[model samples]
Target: MTTPLNCIIVDDEAGAHLVLDHYLKSFSSLTLSASFYNAIEAMEYIHSHPVDLIFLDINMPGVSGMDMLEAMPDPPLVVLTTAYSEYALQSYRYQVVDYLVKPIDLPRFTAAIHKVFRRYRPLTPAQQEGNTAAPPPSSLMLKVDGEVIRVQLDSIMHIQSWGNYVKVYTEQQVYLSPVTTTEIEQKLDKLGFKRIHKSYIISLQHIQKITHGEVHLNSGVILPVGNTYRRDLMEYFR
Candidate 1:
């Protein structure tokens, strides 16, 4: 069997530790080495032991997570955990692998672990021998609910403007991202997506039929095609 990755959790909340303990069992490749309630103890332990990954909480009583990161000259791979999305952009300064919002679900937790493995996992000889032919899937990074998450482009079925936020519809979940529809339209227009109305954008690959100023998606979602956009949208069919 391949060696397991030694990971540690540094969070003051007892609930957080419990949640992690439950999730870690599902990943046999990861082993929890230690759990510290504060950054100081966690830092001292890291100085003396070999740690592969850290699930660090940003807010603490005295020493914050950022302070601990500043003290380490060469820290191991880190995944920042926080309850606020405002710190999302700031966390990127430390080059963390992923920023997970509090009350993290199993799918999100699993996604973060997979990202860690992608960054540190060793490649087999077969992989090293030019076996790479397929390109990586295109994805979009969006800030949602105080966390920056990656959503695969192809998985997106449609987007609907909701006040200051936009609801991103996918096969599994709908993400309410704090991004303007205009901003998202600019980013997705050239990538197999088109703005069908003032409030909606549909994925070209998901379109099943278009009739009478309405675009029908394969997922059974029907969105009205705005008068201003209908002529431009019909260009694709012609």
Candidate 2:
């Protein structure tokens, strides 16, 4: 039997809880362990309970979601849900699995859950029992020069947005695709890529070093880490 992941909701608003509870019912792999209206109570419950995931809200009356994360020496997989988009980059400081804006739809929520699943279960139960080996690396289908092309996730070093188009830097070559950075960010977030700047998204594995506000990729490419995103970028390495 597949082991179900235990999840908890920590949102102050009643409507927020209702929405998440309704959405969660669709996913059988996860079980709702508890719900808390305040960060203090939630923190207390977490101390005594075994929680695998947290659906946290950023704005609360007394204690915020980011505050709770800061207090915990070690935290469970976090998915931040808020009405504001400005908090999106800052929430990554806790290494959250995903940052979801308010009024989240089923499709986006489903994607976030799948990302959590991949992180929680790097190996299947059967693989843990020595039944099979790991799967192959994943790839992304991208439209480049009016043609759809297959790009290996591991081969990508960085991606830079050029107005409506994006330049994907890989080990072999650079592919210019007519896709927005926001669109590609959704696809790459599940993997180990991060949007460290409005115009730049980089593979975490390809980072050689960070110095003075610049990120040096393993391919000898240097990119500026935007001031707004610098905190989250530094938090990633920590």
Candidate 3:
């Protein structure tokens, strides 16, 4: 029995909800736990109930989706939906799983759900008493097929974005995980991993050389630093 992800739709627009609801039905691993036309109603429900994911809109009636998200002391995994592409960078700053523009397509929405499902989840009741679901890693988790296995933070050398999937290069092995670069960036940003390119995120500690807009890792791998990210990368290195 696979654990289903409990998710809720928090968009005021009925049409948005309708589209999302239809797309969500295709995944057996997801459960539409609830739906709210306003943030206030969603707020009340979230306080008492634990949900794994949220499909939030940028603009809502009064409180606004961003407002509620900012107010929440600890918000759930969020996938921001909006009609504006200009807010994409700002949305990622909020550590959202993915930001989807309005009139969400099935392929993109499915990718977002895969991000949430591939994310590390809490232990089952059986695991609390030691049923051997595998002990938690010091910092990172790797998704292998349907299971999310554990990996230490230091073992990660670099990560490459492969369309809807990411390849995690660790000290011992390279793992192919079903998640996006943005999702991996959010997960590893604070852990000393930095996104040097749109397609590459590298471990700062593993850098053997960083010059000519390229980073060489101790593992004998070289990754290109994106022009848009070079300034930030330089700032981090300094």
RMSD of each: 15.1, 16.5, 16.6
Cα-lDDT of candidate 3 = 0.82
Tell me which of candidates 1 and 2 scores higher on lDDT.
1
- Candidate 1 RMSD to the real structure: 15.1
Best by TM-score: 3
Candidate achieving higher TM-score, 1 or 3: 3
Judged by lDDT relative to the true structure, which candidate is superior, 2 or 3?
2
- Give me the displacement of residue 21 in model 1, in angstroms: 1.2
Clashing pairs in 3: none
What ranges in model 1 sit over 4 Å off?
Answer: 121-238
Q: What is candidate 1's TM-score against the reference?
A: 0.51
TM-score of each candidate? 0.51, 0.51, 0.52
lDDT of 3 by residue, 100-218 (tens): 99888999998887787666467788777795554333566555564445678888899999989999988998899887899778767567889989999998899999989899999
- Local distance difference test scores for all models: 0.87, 0.86, 0.82
Writing each residue's lDDT as its tens digit, candidate 2 over 56-130 gives: 999987668887787676789999999999998888878999999989999999999988977774456667789
lDDT of 2: 0.86
Evaluated at residue 135, the lDDT of candidate 1 is 46
Report how far residue 69 has shifted in candidate 1, in Å. 0.7
Error of 2 at 181 (Å): 54
Model 1 per-residue lDDT tens digits across residues 28-76: 9999999999887687578568799999999987778887787675688
